[model samples]
Target: MAAKKKIRSPELEEGHLCYICGKEIHGDHVYIKTRRRSELHIHFECMPGKQQVN
Candidate 1:
């Protein structure tokens, strides 16, 4: 079986920008690591088709 890559959600900072909205993250947010090993941040509400996870 192939191993899954770990996903990390770093704490919001003063200058962090959302990947989708391109605005500073002031509240709840999420993040993703690209294939090139770079991190992208996004606001929670900006995620399309978002669903609540149990």
Candidate 2:
């Protein structure tokens, strides 16, 4: 079976920006590591439709 991407919800920092909306993550957020090992910081509300971690 194929491996799944690593998804985690970490504490949001003061200047963390959302990868989707390009705005600062104010409240809660998620962190994901892609197959290519790229780290993405995304907002909870702006997460991709099919890739909601929570």
Candidate 3:
């Protein structure tokens, strides 16, 4: 049996670049920890299939 790598979230900085748009995150954004154990930052507007809640 093989062990699965655990995903972890790293601290996000204000000037961190967005993984999706490749732009600097200055305001609203989200961070995701990939299966490869890498942290990806993305802006809300740039997020794919993003929907607004009432």
Candidate 4:
């Protein structure tokens, strides 16, 4: 069976770090699951173009 993919909601609290740049996400960030199924929090700008919020 294939693994289920999902886009997790952003953390509303302050002090969450970006997965790519490691900088603090200011507001309205997003979290994506990698191939390994690990969750990573990242800023919208830091996310790759191939990844889109539905």
Superior by TM-score: candidate 1 or candidate 4: 1
Tens digits of per-residue lDDT, candidate 2, 1-54, equal 999997665653356878988998766789899999998989878766756556
lDDT of each candidate versus the true structure:
0.81, 0.79, 0.81, 0.80
Q: State in Å the error of residue 21, model 1.
A: 0.9
What C-alpha RMSD separates each model from the true structure?
11.1, 12.1, 8.4, 11.3
Please report the candidate that would top TM-score against the real structure.
3
- Give candidate 4's TM-score: 0.51
Lowest summed-lDDT stretch of 10 residues in model 3? 6-15
Superposed Cα RMSD, model 2? 12.1
Residue 10 error for model 4, in Å?
14
Residue-level lDDT tens digits of model 1 in 1-54:
999997665652456888898988876678799999999889988898897879
lDDT of 3 at 16: 88
Estimate TM-scores for all models. Answer: 0.57, 0.55, 0.61, 0.51
lDDT of 1 at 30: 85
Which wins on lDDT, candidate 1 or candidate 2? 1
- What is the TM-score of candidate 3? 0.61
Evaluate residue 15 in candidate 3 and report its C-alpha lDDT on the 0 to 100 scale. 69
